[model samples]
Target: MDNKTVLQFQSLSSLVDPTFWYSLTKEKIDNIKLSDVPLDIYGYYSYNSLQSSKSNDNIKVPSFLQLNSNSLTNEIIPSFSFPMKGLLKNTNTIEDFQKLDKKGLFEKVSKKIWDSILNGEAIKCPSLLNQFLLISFSDLKKYKYYYWFAFPALLLENPIYLTNTQLLSDYLNKNELQSLHENYQKLLEIPDNIKKGIPGYFLLKKDDNNHVKVGTLSEWEMFKSDDKNKTIVGFADPCVLPNNPGWLIRNLIVLLKKKWNVSKVTILCYREIAGEYADLSQCKLMDIEISGEELSDNLPKSVGWEKNIKGQFGPRLANLGPTMDPNKLIESAV
Candidate 1:
């Protein structure tokens, strides 16, 4: 294992569908006019993502942690998994959006994640690990939406190094893969688990008999054998890249180091084809080692405000003018 193989995580980007803007427009005009209060919203990532999944023609489509009309509602789409509970702050003006305390906001959210990890809340309800912030200024007049998304991550004192990386399919033999799949499906069948949306992050291990048992984060200790090396921790990976895992894995490693106090661990970046749960070859398995995790109660330096297309620190603009223009809607209707 090369010590130079430092593990890196891919950052998050906002993927707002037109339906989301349309719904927000209706919400603002019909209800939340001029109100700057934050609204409860959620976004989700899936195992069956285009980044890792193929289309009917076998081409890989683009993917994202998308927000649409459904994201604004409480309705749960099973396939739209790992729901990231988020806050939506629609500012009254562009100045307000611009002047918002971005660093302050990032710190605040990161603290919550840190607290959850320390107090064991995240171990119980893993969705808190993926909480996000969305600040926006919807220009109703121009039908353009300006927004920035932040997925805050807690930085560990010691960087996690990649010991080795391999395809998950190749890591496990045919029988072992079958057991993992069967147990995972059983985990998803828990109705309460379905409602709460924390099943994406899981702990699993194989017994001497080669039987696999999947458990919630809270059940980690119960499923653990004497050897931490035997246990594998995993998350539903959202990254399409073959090598890099998604952004949330950073804080998860933090949680593992600080909470579990593990120095070496095996990580499974679980990826699957959308609507095709049987395909797991796209998943990546990694062996990583980390040291020097502080037990201090204070939160570490926070990062993960999504960067702009130019890779600069800035907000992104979504000009939905044409599709949202009322005159064009009427004209096209005629």
Candidate 2:
């Protein structure tokens, strides 16, 4: 592809399950009190999205990233989802939330990503490339939550270009596809991966013997081969579109370019279609050229603060008073 042939990706959409707010409510009333410190939270994107034309589901464009009751807990993340780490900054009052430096907060989170890439940490655990932020104010009395989400992405000085795209089936034979499925399943079976969560980003290695294996980001050095076909970087893609991959691909290209000095790569947009199993038929294979231009001052500009419901740059409000307030529930029952 020429320099003029740029790439476009589908941004990830957040889905905060109701149980998540209930869990936060309990945590706040019981532990947080008047504190405004940020808390570590986790979220995951489901592979079985409804956006695909082949899907039998009713909804369109179902959420890519989701937060549930257990997202803030110290327990195991469930299967069939690719995990991502994030921060939850909950203020004690709405006034405090309103006063926050939104752009500064965005830059802070993005800087962490940039630092990780520079320090070579992101090469070991690529999920750091997908770091996100959430800011909120829980109205205890009114039972309303004012919140916003930001999925930070590094801007490339010279953008990546897509030269080719195809389905996994078209790229690999049936045997190779089976090997990939079995290997990736083993990756999900690792004990620690089950406990915390596995990185959505991973390595797919097909050796000279044509033996395919699944590996983590840390294995990239050892996994690399003279023949480009030997290593394939794959991500558990949440985007259901045929052409556009998910938002996280943006930072991955930058990390690959900056840290490893790789100007081009083949990416597998892995997907699980229809049910709780990996489906190669739904996956997309992409060959792209990453412009390895050095970003000025090593601090790339970022984007991805979620747009409000009105399609403007702002936060959203979730009112739970009628449904969540105990007093209201009791009054309705009486």
Candidate 3:
């Protein structure tokens, strides 16, 4: 295929980088090599592993987190599961790292990635933002923009899901929503009103072809499957914070809202924060029982689960969804 055809293909579809796409076709974008590209272009690259795997075999697009064991190889996606406390010792930026770390369980798994960047072993850690910085870190110092900046900003956002079930079953009662917010402020000392604009329902869409798609409560409409009878629902544990998988959730939500016209979205989270303290004030909070089966099917939004070229730095297998070349988004913006 010529460069134009490749470029055209990238524009019409979801891809992270044309080079990465080319690498995939040439068998370069497999499990473990890093691409030298800008982070913004590849920000959502491989948001889900299952989604990546399906993109190779199936012609259709899959959700970033829809993981089908049948379609994916058994190789586990490498990642470190670090505690919040341990990360503090290695890095000075605690809050920023906490927000960017998501799951707070990566230090050990991403050690190679971290060590590679620190020791200059490889290009950079295999993350969207970090990859770009690692590639251009020396010459780009004048820009004063590093991936670390996003870490703290996104962390300061403090976005989280508060399950209704958790509220009712766990600690907070309906009446306690307000007080809990106050308590959360006192405990975390994250400040008040900083948690605004957080949404409640994390909508996940999967097609009959076994492809998992993700979205926020709003994006639920773009992924309404051909089966008109299907009910769109929340896919993962509502309590989880914004990791790559959660980023998939955020992307799905953001994309759905942009592409589709829908109304009345809600979510069920597994934790209880003050209503004022919770990130999603717009959502109608409810306590519902999310089924285990639904969660399992909806989880891995894509087929390739962390088995792609970039090592453990990208989203987990559960996060990758259909994406276009990163060049498409970043180059155009420039």
Clashes of each: 1, 0, 63
Best of the two (2, 3) by TM-score: 2
In model 1, the Cα lDDT at residue 111 comes to 85
Deviation of model 2 at 139, angstroms: 1.2
lDDT of each: 0.79, 0.78, 0.25
Query: Each model's TM-score?
Result: 0.91, 0.89, 0.22
User: After superposing candidate 2, which stretches have Cα over 4 Å from the reference?
Assistant: 1-4, 50-63, 194-199, 208-210, 228-231, 274-277, 294-297, 330-334
Record all residue pairs in model 2 with backbone atoms less than 3 Å apart, i.e. clashing.
none
For candidate 2, the 10 contiguous residues with the lowest summed lDDT are 54-63
Model 2: how large is the Cα RMSD against the reference?
2.9
| Alpha-carbon runs more than 4 Å astray in model 1 | 1-4, 51-62, 78-80, 225-229, 275-277, 330-334
lDDT of 1 by residue, 1-334 (tens): 4555888888877788898999999999989999988888978777565633334545654246779897778576546466788888899899999898877777777888888888988887787888888889999998999999989888877677888888877767778888988888887887677555556788878755656677887787776546534667888877777777788677778888788787887788887765544777777888888778456787898788888888997889999877889886787788
Q: What ordering of candidates by lDDT runs from best to worst? A: 1, 2, 3
Question: Alpha carbon lDDT of residue 277, candidate 1?
Answer: 47
Residue pairs clashing in model 1 are: 48-274
